[model samples]
Target: MTTARRKPYGVKGAPYAFLLPATVLFSSFFALPIGYAVWLSFHKVHVFGLGLGKGARSEVWAGVENYTDALTDSELLDGALRVLGYGCIVVPVMLGLALLFALMLDAEKVRLAPFTRLAIFLPYAVPGVVAALLWGFLYLPDVSPFSFVLEKLGLPQPDLLDGGPLYLALSNIAVWGGTGFNMIVIYTSLRAVPAEVYEAAKLDGATPLQIALRIKIPMVASSLVLTFFFSIIATLQVFNEPTTLKPLTNSVSTTWSPLMKVYRDAFGTGDIHQAAAEAVIIALATLVLSFGFLRAANRRDKQEAAG
Candidate 1:
């Protein structure tokens, strides 16, 4: 104790000093907005007689009334159902294509691997709104080359922007834009697997498909899970594609997605309190579903390990 030396003040405070900017930025941008939203969720406007004067309206505490209304709202529920249906198509198809492309890229004797990977991934760099707009044009019967070809061939040209096909159209845009990123993630994971493992598999007379199924896939299971997790969250929060396509299609309503509904409630109807409440609900639902999936995945992993 007598021989102990004191640390310099700068060294002792260095970690906090380094973190100060991030802490300030997080508090200012993220934390403050979230706190304000939560605060707004629990408050509503109270209007006096005629609702005309400057002092006529005031903010008042609203308990759980906003949350109750949001839960009971048919529009919100329908939007949730629509998003769920969209997710069902998007998640599996996107992940499947990603895995397929990643495996193909990782295979031996593959030609132009870098070019192929870049071609597949380039769509992801495009903004979602631009992607939607581009696809929206393709979906239009008059402007679409597919429709023109079908007409020339004397075949039926299906309406892609309306009814059942609308879901497929939206799902395609998501899959196209998302597959590349997931493929890269999975491919990176694959590249990290030991070469000796592949050599041993080859020595055991395993074919390429067998090796991929047994060794490669199992080794990349965590990557798959991670992609799946992100896919689920993105699916639930879908807004841009639908919103961008909305102008071109009569089928996409103002309340097409939960987020769209939130936007409509906040700006369209000028009800920030209601919008905040709905936003909070959507955030809570996303959190619950994400964590629930993670928990199930963890439990399965633990069981597999024990087995």
Candidate 2:
């Protein structure tokens, strides 16, 4: 047998040369910072004497002290629970509305589909902070149109910015901002499906709902999975919306979410070591939740294929 030929040096080097800038950027910007955070997580600053000079403050091994503290902190646990509740409301409602709108757009003989689609997606073009600010004004009692409508109808206008209502208020902002983007994604996937599939289903006398349930949804499962993955990640890292709302309302704390808690530790408290530990834990938790859902989806797909 002839020996396998090797790629020429110049040919082999071309790809690496092309990738050099990205590699350098990734290492400098991404990999190195992650490595540094990991290092910081396992270290603590020890004060010597009055802690006045360079040698006065020394870095020592922490041995998971920060991690243990974070894990056992009731404030962190409460914040996590709050986020879980917020996510429960946001994810389903957002994705459900997205899928519904996408199906409606994909339906034949739909009215003003282009205008409606653009209007639904317009919120996506607004910055998250701006969107939150606008919504915060809408939720305010004095300036809210909803409050005005309720007053006209002789109904009590419930405070949307406090207590349990606060959860719904925040969830609404997230859903409104996110649903349009997800709708566009799902709608794009629906458009990719072959027209022949719909033609055959129609010939077989399947109703629009039946086609949506049996064919359209199944065909767009990959897009749903993709959107779900990103939604979960975004929900976990919720910061901007809540941060924007904090100035408008007293209900939101500095440590409203795990990420906020990390920020509080890092800057507010000047404890980088603890902040790094919390950040790492949050990162690991996100990875675990994401991959766990992906694996479950994969297994379901395999089972469906086997059946």
Q: Number of the top candidate by lDDT?
A: 1
lDDT of 2 by residue, 1-307 (tens): 8999997769978999999999999999999999999999999999999999779998999988989988998878888999999999999999999999999999999999899999999999999999999999999999999999999999999998889999999999999999999999999999999999999999999999999999999999999999999999999999987888998889999989888898889999999999999999889999999999999999999999999
Clash list (residue pairs), candidate 2? none
Kindly list the per-residue Cα lDDT of model 1 for residues 142-232, writing each as its tens digit.
9999999999999999999999999999999999999999999999999999999999999999999999999999999999999999999
lDDT of each: 0.97, 0.94
TM-score of each: 0.97, 0.94
Worst 10 residues of 2 by lDDT: 4-13
Candidate 1 Cα outliers beyond 4 Å, as residue runs: 1-9
Q: What is the model-wide C-alpha lDDT for candidate 1?
A: 0.97
